[model samples]
Target: MTLETGAPENGPIMLDHDFFRDPHPVYREIKKNGNKPTEVILKTGMAYIPPGLKAWLVTSYEDIESVLRDPRFAKSIADAMPLFAANAPARQEGGGPGRSSLLYDNMANNDPPKHTRLRKPLNGIFTSRAVAPKRADIERAAAETLDAVAAAHRGRDGFDLVQDFAFPFSIAVICDTLGVPVQDRAAFNSWVQTITGAAGPEELARDAGRMAAYLRDLLRAKRTGTEDDVLSLLARSLDEDEAVAQAYALLAAGYETTANLIVTGFLTLEADPQQKRRLWSDPALVPGAVEEMLRHQSPFNLSLYRYVTETTVLNGVELPAGAIVFLAFAAANRDDRRFARPDEFAIEEPRREHLAFGGGIHNCIGKHLARLEAEVAFGMLIQRCPELSVLAPPAADAWKVSPTFRGLRNLRVGPVPGISETGRAHD
Candidate 1:
């Protein structure tokens, strides 16, 4: 799926299934036709102006870094009124209220003062001082998940790494940390699906309304209850509306992205045997491995939409006010100028920054938690489930379509061979 552009003009390009499934080939083609900064418009009328969505797409690492850190490029989509108005019906109907509020005005969604205010309290929760105590508990949870998988499979046939391992593992850890009631797990899981899955506009609106009603009810109960949970913490800290908003934010932030990382990390490790072996041999490398995995397979292909606050020139391309931009973090991670052997997945590569969790003030607040979760979860899997292998082909080969995330819908795995009923493997 190569897209050939002539002379790098700014115009909309039809986004076919191939482009959505695998955008790299098209990105390379666009690069070939255009200069350093190019504007590749999507058929949906959304522009892919780089660095900031309002400007031209910054393909080079230096330019992307500069744009990401630059305050001139506004992160607020509300700034682009005309664009938002044009897309409002679609946007509103597609995951309004409970589902979209998390990304709409939470710390990650806002810029400057608003961002700072929202991020302050949440940031404290993820710092080393706060998170260090949870490490042992996290490790124990990971081990317990592996034990459950082993018991279920009994070293026979295969198991789904995504559903049976990563999904449940992440959910359980987050639930335990947040103190969500065990009885609500089923509803929470269903709500997450409605929020993240590709539902029709009407369906999305319906789901959002349903989720809001549910959360409101849950909040009311928590307000009168004796239990201490994340909801309770937020309730005590913020007003009712604000607390409910934070509840939505936590759900969106806590689940999908981590699930994508866990699934992609496993697939990447399975695909590259040498890297996997290195990870297995050196437990200390787990953190680096997780970072590299985050870089190599960025869960969010596109950053949140940002509108042009004013006319701006990025990398020699002029962008007008109200222009929509999508910072392609996935593309930036693979930029040759920033990363040596950018295509390769090497944990041993000297540490360098990547925009996997984004950059600037809008960088992920839960980064530490995500990293801790991945390190513990992946390390446990490799150590305990030594025979882990891909249940399905790579995502590119499978070509599953998702709007905001790229992940295998299903991942299967087999246990290490030669293990006895007592779980001892014959060498």
Candidate 2:
């Protein structure tokens, strides 16, 4: 297998460089054997692992979508990895808190009843209409972020879009939606950074607990009397534990995914300047372009850990009860069977079915919000900095390594010659 920094990964899938930087090639190799969504038992000497990465890796569009929609394909990370779940530090090392503090709380990775209960209260807020009013706000946030980047690089030619624009732009929208206290916003980034795979397990556990406590306290404060923000609405109904869960989900899900999308959208367009020109020429294509970006450049490589609820069969692959399976989102999006010229970037595809935000009941609740943010972000970006061009491929040496999430460490874009007149790039 080709790797980004180190020697080639000729073994099983671990956190290999080749897989992260341009995973399409690796994904094609997985399908080369013509046994997509193949069944295999991960063993030592074959797979190069960094620690507790043990699961049934699922690829192929049909199988991935099937698994995602299948009720038997469970999302219980605890039952799937019981040993790791019991060991808190090891679990944290693997990926933050386990069953007790996380699985039950995070609706994105849990099964029904509990999942239903957790997701019920805040569903209304994420719907398209509910999020419609925030379009102007998101646009403003994008513009403001671009403004800061412009100011910083006034004399200079370039800046890091991930640090200067993508992250800040996303965080701004989240802060507004959550009504995160002005004072709390500063500390908020520190807390989010800890969870973003920057801190070690011990630090992660401590930070997660601290952040949970902070959110719980914030919920309690809002419970007295509050407005229509999600937290305020949740505060009225949910207990501290429940409120903390919802708040954490909202905060984590809201910004990170959109931030990556923002970075990828710009980077992808930059890679293919002609496509960027087409998009810039046709403003109506912005929404469809966002869909294509989601399909082609999925931010999260795989879905959260899923356990087999019962005996299941997919394309002759027998999965025993309680077996672990990771639904491959990025791979499925590029499946040749599902997409025409699957690897190529097409702004306007005739058929585009992407699992970037997942599907079925456990699908991303904030997908509409994420889409809106991207629509405004790219639209504003093309308008705000027309001279913007990539210095190099936006791929980075350091990546946020998480089993569930994938994001660039930094994306350095150059040739930005200050903020341009909004209408100057009419070409």
Candidate 3:
């Protein structure tokens, strides 16, 4: 895979079966050899992007951090895409365009000034400082979901934890956090699924439109005012479209990633029984265990392409403005240069910092909430079901279909669920 010019060569490779089965090997290949501008083909069905786009990937840990922190890397998806720009208007002082959900100016799709506007007011709500009150909600959600799993399994050997437990648990927490009314939850859940679920670009765009419209209406209602919920606070701070985007971010960030973390963390523990037993023996290690799980199975394989906004060079590699680049978080997380046995899972791994939450300014907003959710969710699972085990060996197709997202499509667990000594669940 070396270049003929005695330099490294990168792709125009298709994100095919081998990639879906395991992208890590390709990530390693990119890490070892790729240093110049290269193209990774993305099909339209892969995501909301109308596809056929080329993305240059940066895989080294240092370079990943560099690009994420560098202000020159554009976050506006509209800026990276001309198709989006025709529909999306200028980034207004209050918000960017809401022409399409795919092109909507959410926090993930904006550089600073716009990003700061969308993110600033929501920070206090999503902070560790705010996690304590929701701790009870998160814990109850976890315990209750596990309880349902136990009830459904009855005398059975397994249940789909991904659907029955992890998915709704995260969705419920987000709904409660956003103060979406109990009556509106069904509609809310539909929108979340449409955004996060596997669907073609046309379907995703339609769903995104439906989601955007619903949120716009919801945001309008919130503008009349309430003391609670992130949306109401955002409505007061931002304009109509900006408020809707911020509200959308809450659902977008809160759902899929958190769900994947719970599922992935559980699967990781199941795979390494020795490590699982160690965590059970010393439950104080759960926090660190959560971190290790996050690093070991970073929910995202590649970051959204960061368009080079200016000519940039770092560590002797140069990229011109308008160049599309992606930070391979999964690759960087497992870089041997930075981590001790990069591929192995160990709770006490000394270097725990990872690009899982991304880095620098464009980092995830719901991260603290996500971490707390994982802690409560996985902690409840291990403490209650000490005998928890995956029913069937993981097959290749068990992984999610999306090239960027990595999560188990189905994680069936148990040899019959057990009640905790504290009465968290009963048969």
Model 1 agreement with the true structure over 43-78: per-residue lDDT tens digits: 322211111112344555666677777676776534
For lDDT, the strongest prediction is 3
| Runs of candidate 2 exceeding 4 Å displacement | 1-12, 38-50, 77-104, 394-396, 416-427
lDDT of 2 by residue, 257-352 (tens): 898888877778888989989888787898999999998889886676677768776665566676667777888888888877888888877245
TM-score of 1: 0.84
Which residues of candidate 1, in runs, are more than 4 Å off?
1-10, 14-16, 33-37, 41-58, 77-82, 87-103, 224-228, 394-400, 416-427
Error in Å for residue 236 of model 1:
2.1
What TM-score does each of the candidates earn? Answer: 0.84, 0.86, 0.87
Please list all clashing residue pairs in model 3, or write none if there are none.
Answer: none
TM-score between model 3 and native: 0.87
Alpha-carbon error at 139 in model 1, in Å? 1.6
Measured by TM-score, the strongest candidate is: 3
TM-score of 2: 0.86
Each candidate structure's count of clashing pairs: 5, 1, 0
Given candidate 3, what's the lDDT at residue 1? 34
Candidate 2 lowest-lDDT run of ten: 41-50
Cα miss at 158, model 2 (Å)?
Answer: 1.3
Root-mean-square deviation of every model: 5.4, 6.0, 5.0
